[model samples]
Target chain A: MNTAQHGTWNRLFLAWLVAAVSTLGALFFSEVMRLPPCELCWWQRICMFPLMLLLPLGLFPLDPRVVRYTLPLALAGWGFALFHWLLVLGLVPASAQPCRRGIPCGEVGIQWLGFLNLPLMSLLAFSLIIALLASTRQKVSP
Target chain B: MKQKLLFALAAIVLLLGFFLASRLHTDARQEETRQHTALNQANLLRMHSPTLGPAEASVVIVEFFDPACETCRDFYPFVKELMAAHPGQIRLALRYSPFHEGAGQVVRLLEAARRQNRYWETLETLYASQQNWVQHHSVQLDQVWAALQGTGLDLERARRDMEDPAIAAIIQQDMADARALRVERTPEFFVNGQPMPSFGRQQLRALVQEALRTGGN
Candidate 1:
């Protein structure tokens, strides 16, 4: 009802758009590009993909209360993406890879600039989306 | 103030994406151009590999396949169709990657058959009847031999040559080369040394088309 909460709509919608793109990107790599998704990547996707639908429903009426529902999911997705990136970077060990397929999860099918891969890109995207959502929550609560 | 920060970060994400897309586009173009030059001007054929097209063909498909791989069996007809359709314009250089149990022995037999000039027949027979020899958990060499009984191959000489160190060495070389190219799965392809960016017959066909555009018929 107040001006402070009015612009939470911007943050919420943009974060939703990012989550939407992230979901589609994951599908594009797996389905279109024929790259297999690792288990951790799948967990991150499980956490992130629902936001694509849930956030928009929250935004239809521009409710600041959406933070109660979205933040936890964003946080969880961000955690998974961070862990997956760590596994891909070899900052963690192979024993931690957690997948037993013919192809290893940490296998660098696409490496760029010596430190960037799909997982890292995913981590960065979720982090931004989370930051935006949390900022909206800060303005929304009191 | 919050909106400003959010929009600023969003702008950066969008800009980073554009930068990556443009850089990748340039890199792919450069790489394709490099391969086009090699295909047009150089000879990269493997003299010992089994082939299914004319030597003077402008487009060449080099496929690394395993006889026992289910995916390779699935792609067999598609690769055949590509060759059949293009006739002399598309050539396929078949490389062996024996990924399953006893696949190396079968590859050895194929090589041994090559010595007797029955390479194509043996490959066709093995692929056509892949189920008889390649089992769920094991390979039946006797069944494979039985399948080859009337194909006019000298079974005794094939058995002897299968054990030959020279035959073993070729298998070793092909495996080494596949690893160097990071071929993780069966039916991996390179069109005139242009690697498919993804796994699909359509990707292979597109790369072949690109190569033919440069190399010419």
Candidate 2:
């Protein structure tokens, strides 16, 4: 209703944006690009897909408690994406990787900027969501 | 400044924990593999594995395919084309990969048909009618059975044979081989034990050609 409340709501919208973009990007990669998802990709999807629905439900009324729900999902997704990124870079050995067949664990189905691949992009998006969520927080005592 | 530093440090530790946990978990898996007893030959290819083309052909194509996979249905004709082109020079092996709901039941149907010496016909019929039954991630079994009427299958026999423990064992073996080979998707093809270099119609043709040249015999 007031200016400060409106500002808080808009800032919180970043969580919604991250969820929408990442979910659509995943669907586009699978449905449009015809790239099959590997096992880790599927795990990452399981984490990311829920936030798209959950974050938007918190909007309209624009509750700050949305962060409490969305941040846990974003963190879990970031963990999967981090492991996936390391696997892609061969930081994890073939013997130690979950994706040994089908599409392989280290495949870069898409890349841009000479550095951004799928997992990095996922990690970046999740990091932004977490940061945006944190920024909207009104100081907690311990 | 101190709060930001602490937040950054905590984030780093959380990430490190994930990475290390994955590494340790896979390390344990690798150790398990080293200790795994020799895999049974039956797991790799049962005596009853489905086949197309010649049984003793020089080139063997092992495709791990789920009955409910749309991609498998799409790839079916291409596989047939390759076999037709090569005549008796190539053999196509079908390994069950019932990764979808109701896919195991379809596998049982196919196995039962194999018992009646009607495996190829049943496979073609099921694929041709995949759209009618595979609805919203579930199989319409009654529709599938309806489509099978007057197809020369002894319907009563098929129903009885579907419950056979042999069929269960065959499906169980295929799933194990799929896990051992790390097959995560349907329509995965291996030509003479060599995985297709990449997934494409052209890549499949190319791999089959390479196999034919080197070991086609």
Candidate 3:
């Protein structure tokens, strides 16, 4: 394969890897860390989990347009995560918070580390996937 | 081609590393919050002298109650209902608060009843019949003791345990715990060491169910 072909594969593979790790990270938080997922986290996960299948499908057929198809869905997922993170950080009023099991999502822990909590991390992962997909699509078609 | 694969792997690893680092930081924050919570709860437990339930139970329900408080009397049925719904899942730790007139004597009598292993039955009976006895200020202490005759309890031991200093300390520690938790009224409930907000019975039941589902982990 030429350098361009190689680069295209690399970008797609990286995107898949990042998406998988993020999903697994979410699982670890929910199952092992015992932090229950709020409604927003669940929505993000639902959007991302499909990429586990989509990534491999895109890789085998060498159809970069596949990434385009998944990109919109993934972007929408990130939007939810970003909105949830903003609600958690109190950038917005709690009326925007998602309710799960009768408890508001904002009431749970806010930021994790200096920046990333569940929602922000999810948003970052989704963004990375989007960037990789876009880059790979450009390499394949152009 | 190999270099591209190497770059991809490196980028993926870096992303994972960043995520792990952030999670570690969150874990540290959670640990600090947990420690602060535990210490606060311990202090409250020490002050209130609340009765300790079986240490083996997965969930602990600590309650602050005044024998003569109408609210406390009203909450008794709810408590009984909860216990009935989730048998052995929860252990009830009752702390007597003498904030109301005649509550101290009633608490003593209830503690004394524990010597016969009839503490719960006696407490339930008293709560169910609170209006009948709580207002009789001139009633003799022995008459209260006599009321337990048909419950198949040891009347003598029940009377004796009422004044036990050890029991008094337990009750006091519970009161302190309630104070620390900022519980100002009777019938305040704490599920697994967390202060429950004022909510309806359905909401409270849902909270407990969620706590159970989470295994209190």
Candidate 4:
């Protein structure tokens, strides 16, 4: 394999590892810590869960062509995570806010273990995936 | 070729570092807010019960609850489970606020149930069936009358007590206590006289454990 091929494989593996860890970390935080997730957090989780499988599927064919398909998934996940993180940080107001009934999302403990809210962690994971997909690009003929 | 890999790795490291730094900033801010909330809780607890706990208990949990609030009903089971698990180590006090309209009767029925040594039972039953009464236009004497039937409560006395000035006074006192604490919600709690900033069972347990370790008042 050439240097570029080797680098692509390395980046893909690293990205998948990050995505897996982030997803598992989120599960542990919610289940073990008993931290109930809010609605936006739930949506972000839904968006990320599929990528956990999709990214690994991309690796099976070892085709750079897979990057074209995976890139959209990465971008979509990143968009959801970005929106959720901003909602958590009060950067953007939450759409379809779910606080009217029970413990408002804002009231739940944010930034556990120094600084990891559900959304920020999701953002980190999505960002890693995007970085990996971006790295796979080849220069196009003009 | 090696330089590119190193660059990619470096970028990853940098991004992770930025994420960690941002998280730390938010955590520090939340910690400060928690400290201020704790101080406010301390003042409120002092006004209500200066000593904090029963003379022999290991921890004290003070909850400010509104009878008609849906969230309070949702949180009731969790609190009950905590109390059951801790038993003698945990002392609990329920302060009532009739924040929602027509909650006064429910509060009175609860107090009457306490008089009969069935406070926990009736409280649990009421919470389990809160949906029935909370949606009604009026929870006056009729609601209390209906709630007492088949709950093993003395319906006649429960209804009589609903109109008792003393019952009204107790409810008023609870509202006053809630106001002093700056409790803005239905199910606010204080562990060892410190405001509970979060509602998860593990978080509540951790707070209680911290109080026990500190030899809480």
Candidate 5:
């Protein structure tokens, strides 16, 4: 209701923006670019896609409790993104491969700016959303 | 009132994004197909690439494949089945893409098997035991050799032949042709010198069927 509340709402909006962009980007890659998601990417999408819907609902009311719902999704997505990053980096062993068919998870499909790939991009987006939600949790708590 | 406005705005943006994406996809596909249409037919085949089915078959399926790619391995049987269904009417020519980390070695091994006239058997052996040899998206060369045991190939000769410069040249030539065709992924197929309208099993089968109906030998 106050200026401080408005600021917290802005952070929530920022989190929503990140989720929206990530969700749309994932769609663009799969639907438009025709790059099929591997199993790990699917798991991560399961986590990220919901945040795009959930976060915006919290924004209109400026609910600090929004962090309660969105943070979990962001965290789980972050975990999957981390696992995928490690898988592509060859740190995850072959025995753990979830993609037994279709596109292999370890195949680096898109490389932007020389080194940044899709898994890394997903990792960064989830990380940013988590950080934003964590900060909003502290500032908006009465 | 503000909440309704915000939700409506979000919906609009999402819908616009999806619409834009679909348009982009259509335009890109048209451009890609046009480019593929202009590609020289000679770029799609090589004398040295592994071929199956009757030599005089009117329908030729050229596949850009990676030995270490799982989809390529999985689709191998389906492609073989397609050729079988058509019998002598459909011929298959495999071009090595070898985009994976250790795939180059496996391709080299397969080429060596060709020297001993065991290319098909060696490829089958590798596909049957692909999981054992392909580790962390890279080919385990030793495991690949172990998997090839049932193929009755002379391993020593194959190994020595793997180092042959001519084999390397074959790989290089296939790769150059793959580039010419703009093949960025494994298991990409061209039926009768035509690229798939889109990439999938059904699309490949449909293309082959069309070819068979119109141009069967």
Candidate 6:
């Protein structure tokens, strides 16, 4: 209702939008395009998928405490995405790859628009969501 | 206020329904692509590749593998178990894609094992102890020979046959087929002439199961 709360709500909503879009994009790649997610990808998905719905549920009446609940998920997803991106870029050693059984984490299955691969896209999505959530938290605290 | 909240929920539900519906069409679309490629690219899928399982099995799994590749070694037992689990429904054709340095020598050794009617045994032995024989993505021929010894292969004869020009030609042909199929990595799989929509044991299993359901026709 207040100006600060209204602005925080906007940030929360934007973070929700990013989560929603990222969830759908992940589904499109895995379900529609039939690209199987690796172990790290699955872990990131676990963190990102719930925020899509949770954020909106929090926004229905505008709960300021929502940031407390969602921030951890976003941060964990960000970490996984960052590591996956590094692995894809060959910055991570092959010996350190976590996905030993199924699709190797290092393999770049789908590259879009010439340069953007799945891991990089995931990292970007998580980064945006985390950034939005961080700003929302800053406004909600005081 | 309640109407606005309901509307948003409905919109999300609608989008979710659309994605779920699209999933039903995915298999058909993939099957179409598989059939098209299978028909036009039969030559690329088959060669003098070594095969396992019954000759008339309906489902054929064509695998492009590097003998020295760690992932390929990791998958060998799993593939065998899958074939066994299906009981005459699946066949496997293995093509060499010796991408690792000095891997061709291992492939040649494997080819020589075929002459003594011990191809699969030798391959299994080598894969089981692959970590001992492959170092830093390169094949250690002496270690590989040591590993193969347990398979009862005549090492002297195998060494002599490893130099046979025919073995080199097989590797050359397989490498060419690998290139033609755009295989960039080891352990690439094609079930019933359909490359995995993506890499993963689960994906490969699903493709194989689908092929089995269709009787591979």
Candidate achieving the largest TM-score: 5
Q: What interface-residue Cα RMSD does candidate 5 give after superposition?
A: 2.1
Query: Candidates ranked by DockQ, best first?
Result: 5, 6, 1, 4, 3, 2
Q: List the residue pairs that clash in candidate 6.
A: none
- Per-model DockQ against the true two-chain complex: 0.14, 0.04, 0.05, 0.07, 0.33, 0.21
Pairs that clash in candidate 2: none
Tens-digit lDDT string for candidate 1 (B144-205): 99999988999999999999999888888888777666566888877876777667888777
* lDDT, ranked from best to worst: 5, 6, 1, 2, 3, 4
Displacement of the residue B10 alpha carbon in candidate 1, Å:
8.4
Task: Write down the RMSD of candidate 2 (Cα, Å).
Answer: 13.3
Once model 2 is optimally superposed onto the true structure by TM-score, how far is the C-alpha of residue B17 displaced, in angstroms?
Answer: 26
DockQ winner between candidates 4 and 6: 6
Model 2, which residues run further than 4 Å from truth? A1-142, B1-43
Docking class of 2: incorrect
Q: Global lDDT of each model?
A: 0.79, 0.79, 0.70, 0.67, 0.87, 0.84
lDDT string, candidate 5, A1-142, tens digits? 7877877887888788888889898998897877888999999999999998898778776678989988988999999999999999999997898896668999999998987999999999999999999998677756
For the predicted complex of model 6, DockQ is: 0.21
Which TM-score value belongs to model 5? 0.69
Worst 10 residues of 2 chain B by lDDT: B33-42
Task: Rate residue B21 of model 3 by lDDT.
Answer: 66
For model 6, residues A36-78, the per-residue Cα lDDT tens digits are: 8889999999999999889887777888688889999999998
DockQ of 3: 0.05
Report lDDT (Cα) of residue B125, candidate 4: 78
Better of 3 and 5 by DockQ: 5
Candidate 6 Cα lDDT to native: 0.84
**Residue-wise C-alpha lDDT for candidate 1, range A1-142, written one tens digit per residue:** 4677566887887887788778767766775455788788788888888887788777666677777888888888888888888887789888877886566778777878987888888888889888888889678767
